[model samples]
Target: MCAKTLRSVHEHRKPASLRGRSFKRPTTGRFDINGDERKFKKKHSKANGIVSPMPNGKPTTSKKVNGMVNGVNGHAVVHMEDEADTSSGRGVATSSKYAAIQEQRANLPIARGETHSTIPAISIHDPSFATIGKEALLNEFREHDVTVLLGETGSGKTTQVPQYLLESGLAGEGMIAVTQPRRVAATSLAARVAAEQNGRVGSVVGYSVRFDERSSTDTRIKYLTDGMIFRELLSDPLLSKYSVVIVDEAHERSLRTDLLIANLKTIQQKRNDASQGKGKGKEKEKERLKIIIMSATLDAEKFAKFFPGSKIIYVQGRQHPVTIYHSAQGQLDYVDSAMRTFFQIHVDQPPGDVLIFLPGQEDIESLDNSIRLYANQLPPNQQEVLICTMYASQAPGQNAKVFNATPPNTRKCILATNIAETSITIPGVKYVIDTGKCKEKRYLAKNTGGGFDTLMTRDITKSSAMQRAGRAGREGPGFCFRLYTEESFKSMALSAEPEIMRSISALKTLFLIGGLDQSGEITQLGREMAAFPLEPVYSRAVLASKEYGCTNEVLTIIAVLSASSKVFVDSSEQRDAVAEARKKFKHGSGDHLTVLNVVRAYKDVALSENKSGRREWCRKHFLNERALLEANDIREQLQQTCERLGIDWKVSCGDGDEPVIQSFGQGLAMNTAFLQPDGTYKQTMGQSTVKIHPSSTLCDKKAPTIVYDEVVYTNQIYARGVSIISKSFLAGLGALKVRQA
Candidate 1:
């Protein structure tokens, strides 16, 4: 069913009291129902009153009422029928207000060819309709099975192209699937498109991400992450549910995005071959899957060569001209240079917000601190400055504040990483400070085994530098101050290397688990691992846990790892308190066992307290309540995945540290490292030097051998999520050879 049909069914099912009601706009600019206008009356209650300012800058009177009401000169009024009281008596007034607004909208005059809808109508006067090359894009899709769409930053390709396909009836019986590189983009775009279509979300338009989904069977247009679509391929190899697949943000070239494009190409070939040999009826003919590659800075010729005879469509972006400034000399410390440039723009430039792009959280924090110290020296007459931070691990609530409008007589300086480059848009940003560097994950190759390291900070590509500069021009004409010289930018690479060159373990594991023979054919295990929504290493660990007799414990550990990092909150002020509270859950075996203890204790506390109490418990103990809650959700989902793969979900070796450690070690045998005499650790397989991170519980303690979740280079090379393991246990895994120095 379409959204319009669903909405009609819902309208017919409304309560009798709400149906056939007449609404009128009163002379006072307020809603009056059934031709009746009631006088304002004040009522007193036990709760305190709220006072708000009116348009004239005078405070409006407030009074207690049975439910929430619009403040009108201290009046407590109810606009709906008396019998339609809410369970809490507070929601009725809000509902009645919305109902009146809907009725008023329904009675509004429509254009000659416009259709009426209960939902707000989308304006047809959007500038994209006039500027975008709509006819050329539609014609390319109509003629070719594959097409590469190149658009500049504000080109409207992301939103406009999908709607064009929907309106042209290209979706057929399947959905028009659009893949985004980030969850925020997918969800926000889906909501925007749903509004433009005059429909509700999850009906005509929807989105799906890692832990959340708002799509339904009635959905004709779906937006999802690249990773989510990759998982879908394991079940529906032909993508039978989607007629058109759009890969957006292909310029980023993330690991999953590249994998998805490669797989889609293969699927396209097989489907075409099948269609050529079919004695098909008119209704049973298989429709060839149409693929559209959309990017803001995509190399059109390269993609054209990859997909033979593929057409390319270019759309012009609507962006203000941006002034670029390059450094005369390279500075030893980019952080200091960024600080000076930010202050210069604030004092000399016109009133506008500033966005400073740094390498990581540490760099952002350092620059933010320096800005504050310098801000204090400003004259009292100068406007105040508001500083915000943006990073991957930032709390969601705090992240929202970065997008809020700047207050009058003040400016906002958002210190961010590459996350703000293309994933999010911040308004009122007219100036950009580019550090010209970012942390990229790269794989190290040695004679022996090697793992991935993510702390390698390097100069960004010329393409990325341009993307950062484009942020300044999003709102209006602006300026970008690069900390590097023009000569240095010209020496940079054309684009960052693809993810396939950086990490191959997940790909290798996928092939192994798929049960492909020596020739690399898919096996049963590979199909199961693809269905599991986890990294290949973690997926393999879960499957191995069943054989090692600790599936339940390993499931919990993997889910927690997948959900978030260590649950302990890192606050300098509460460091001692957090460590003291965490003592109750320490298992001495390693961080993995400690995580198991934390999850079990959380469950126990949740069973004993109410919702608020559980949240309070986390705060009191300095634990991340969100991470723990997300872990629980993932744990339930992983349990279902295990059951579907025919792995026993209830098997356990009882509550002991040995079995759990052994189970996790089975999959992480190559990650084992042993202590050395020089107070450093070396990986048993790769022979790489490593050290325990200072944040780990076992940081100061000495252990002969340990297993780690990952290696990170910050102040120095360190292994995070460290845990002590028995030498005998390492030897028992069979992949490691126990050798003593």
Candidate 2:
């Protein structure tokens, strides 16, 4: 199910530009690197001139208060340790330890924000930084095996806590892991923290996400998506390399996050118990694992209760008062209401960027066009509205444009999906328009055994509403205009149900793929399947491909299916062109064969064409090159995995597509459906009737029997990525009778 929430500070703060230079910090009293307090004699600077507190020490036209502009970088001091050796004269240079510490302190974002000031301060504006002393925070972590920290948005917990543990040497010789729900958050937060550490990414700080990873042995603290870490568990079941695992955005409770949470409990118990039996010394203590579960909402109690002895520590967040206004009645059409609200804010409110939250890309695009059409009709005296649309499927260039600075006399308006609701800070947003609606993906389990994903729009939970409103307050005092009434908000659920409760359990999917036995225990085959970063079904397909002697073709198609973006880019204006281009690779069997054909054609083109020619070829065919390149990466990884598993990835079935289709049938047996008397298809294992998706090549074809990749419910139950299969071939697969436990 697709889940969307409002803009809230769930985990990260946007990093400001460092401008390719570092600045000196104030000569504040010394602080201990190990979370202790220390004092040293102040050193004098040789120059009497004032150094601008900003990066590069340059003056700007923008006004600043306490070296800050709208709660962002300006004259902020981050005193990590002493600057020089205090045992000797003031001019004496310190040892390499002090030098490294000084360099690190200068590189901090807060230090770059500061001017030449003598005032001693340590992020007084951040609730977590201001309220929780470094020593006290470390002490709690040192004392507890697990910590349930309830920190509001902008609390500095996500960014600061890792640094705190690293500096205090609490992480010992092992790396510290911080898991995010989204890849964008994982990579961006790593960049921000790397900046804070005065080091480059992939060195002191790194991140690992699917298809892309930038981490090395030098990395001390790593940020990775929950899915990546969960995959890591397959290789290192006990997570022996990590001393601490901080699960950020625990409130979101995504499917992968829930899996990690459950597995962590068992992993922690085993690791800690084994370490405890090793003689109860400091070295053995370092072998134990530590967990910190952080949430932005009121669900910390739930996590605390789950961990039993885990301590719940609440950290106040630095938030400016956000004036919230609810509508007098319900909004029948949220898109229309959002458009009206944007124009109202543009014509009536003071200057500042406006952020409008929508349910999905369709709504975002609708509101974007409406706002643009109306903005042109506004009087010339009014500020022009600059619109930016954001969603998961948007191009990288389009998403990057959202972070660009607003032009003079132009009011920036961001039309975003729930992606903007958490772990991202959109600058210049002082007014928010929340559409109290979101789309959630739910798995409708059938009594007969199979299930389909349902993407349905519905009212958001109260926690989501607060998160959406919190976006406006990121920079400074802001206002939130809720499209729904206060009563509507009050009647909403307190929080979202954990993803495990809404979707098919991962264990069930694993069991279906023979990853687990009837007794619910992982098998050796399951362990091998987990080695590849793929869905269990796709992994099963690869294994079956080996037996079918179509490993080469199956790998190509599965890689494309696993790509983050769609293989084709569809545009309304280019519908005819896209259709005509698609005909070159269209296969009569269906989408799966069509994908293999496209990959083969691309390979031929790559061998014959130059870089520019390859780009032109892709452009002409309306193919997404990024998706192709990503697929290539996944295919390479899968090939290596296959080699390790003693399965020849180069095994091919020549030019015949039958073996490839039959191989997929082996893995997708449960996804099979047969033609019904009413000219529709009924699932082989379930009673649900489904139609071939319009995008499928076999949309209007009368295929007697077909196997699909998945079924999605929007306006109707539609089977996507379909291929025809012989009934006799499907009947040979007796595994379809495997019942749910």
Candidate 3:
């Protein structure tokens, strides 16, 4: 099977550099050693919404590079060392005290090579680390040159690869950077790596997140959310200090990773030129950083082809043989079949935890209610089962409980959303129930009026199916009971959709960077974004605080809204009451303004009483207390960004924290749409058939409104709504849309 091939590929092939062993010299001696028949990496089609260099010393690029729909140069800017490793000015090794540091890192996981460009040297560490098997290596790893690391959920590859390189004597010149798609992954992985090295979290292995960091002077291995690493590239072009950069979970194709790969390749070429010329600063360490991409199910060959000369290694997942069963007869009936399966598995199945993947919040709730009703059907005390629901929009406390386990003699049933596909790892899970469906956000190609959007519940992709299966067997040999047939899975796409074509891009912040003053290309602002521990959109929002003269306030707002940090309360009455109070200040600008008003109102409450009193204030309005805390975190980060950029950050709630409304409308409306007289919406930029979602506060209202997500996701874009706003805030903020003229 595929697993065997994964092992064979990495085990057999000798690193290409083994042939050039004789010419290997310290640092720089010859371009012959550095230059090869295959030096530049392969390239790929670029995604949309990325920042590019404008023709007039601006952000937009003259020509769109690769297949990128929007304007952007597709490449990651990895730091490069002096070409050929010539006598370097500031090298990590060859220095005195750092040797001890290097020696101590021997136990850490790293790639095998001398500098990033050079493979393992005899004087360095032995080239052979873990014997992958020769024939397998030659046949698989070398054949494609792009490795798809599909290890079962708990494989050591994610934590060990960087350590392997460091120990193998590869990349001795700088730290190893690993990009994780989520914040939890970054924080936990860094902690785990540090623990293995006996150093404090901040020393050998560290992490830098939006409001937190475990990094210090002695750290060499760092786990960073993908965006943070991207931002770091702004200051350290060539990513010179890193020996290797690992792009993890690339199949997810989160916007940051997609943009980063192109940047890294671009920087590697720049490093070679700088070292070859009169460039100064530690530009003498000549080595094109090696990029090791770790994906679950995405096409590794595609990436391998994208980056020429890169090596690909596949790690087969370790999953138990679980019988995949389809919906038995009445399966199409929503509650009936799903609930029936739940009872049968919980009572008749083995003693492991169960994970049932559903579509959206409604599905999770319906299934949960069915299970509870089924629980009552049980004879008293016959079975004490613990049931939990998992969804993106759920309250924080409830979601946490789902990740935790149940008491003894009680079985655990986790009703989950797509978040379980990769985000969180549940400890005791051994069985899985797949709903075979997921709700995804879809962008209408024609809709440009920019008022609202739409979402749909669709079948899960094969990669997602496999990912769900992998979850069951993470701890040991586990089983996954898929609800769909293998035939259905085969028809699914190999990967999820890329971010650019779907999500919003923040070109506003890119304009502020020292070097980049436009949304099209990577400039100083774009580069600074690559360094931050936040998403480009959020990072842009925070960075823009400088322009608007509100750094302190924006920081707090962003931190509170990041990955899994949203804090909307559950009670609709309370939510409505709070919303109503904040609505008094509604310039009718948009949702963002509503949020601002809430924040300002919160500040007023916080000032009147102690922290506990503030919590009470949040409770009375149905607002999440945690969200308030996160807003505070955002503000703090904004404040720090101000300090770093020398921008003045004055924290004040004047105007009740409301934004200009008109400006925000412009940004949100660019991709929105407007409903026509015939009831069919004419989307922004000339698209059609899009409907407003049902979840918007303006859902039942007759006035046209701009929205954030579709009905399947949040219900404000695909069902109904007049296009009173411009596709790009076209209707202008404060222009109230009444019933007709």
lDDT of 2 at 266: 88
Error of 2 at 513 (Å): 4.5
For residues 8-106, what per-residue lDDT tens digits would candidate 3 score against the true structure? Answer: 322332333322212121132211212231121211123111122121222221121111122113322111100111122122233453443344233
lDDT of each: 0.67, 0.73, 0.53
Residue-level lDDT of model 2, residues 1-741, one tens digit each, is 000111111111111131222111213332111111111111112211111112222222112221222343442333211111122221223466446545544443322322111111212122233334556668778989998776655456777789889999999988999998877777777766676666767888888998678889999999998988977886798999999999998988787887888888888999888987876567897889999998764565667777877766655444545666777777666665676677667877799999999888767765675566556656678888899888776654567788999999999999987878874568789999989988898887765343678888888987888788767765566778888876676678878988889876467667776889889988997888878778888888898898899999999999999998888875545779989999999999899999999999999999999998998898889888889999999999999999999999999998888889888886777788888888789887667899999999989898999999999998889999999988898677555454642
Cα deviation in Å at residue 538, candidate 1? 2.1
In model 3, the runs with Cα more than 4 Å from the true position are 1-150, 272-286, 316-321, 327-330, 447-452, 501-564, 571-593, 608-613, 639-653, 656-659, 666-741
Ranking by lDDT: 2, 1, 3
Show how many residue pairs clash in every candidate, following the order shown: 8, 11, 125
Q: Model 1, 532-586: lDDT tens per residue? A: 7777667767877888778899999888899854477654446588789988888
Highest lDDT: give the candidate number: 2
Candidate 1: stretches off by over 4 Å? 1-133, 277-286, 394-398, 447-454, 506-531, 564-566, 572-581, 652-654, 734-741
Q: Which stretches in model 2 have alpha-carbon errors above 4 Å? A: 1-131, 202-204, 210-218, 275-281, 394-400, 423-425, 447-450, 505-513, 608-612, 733-741
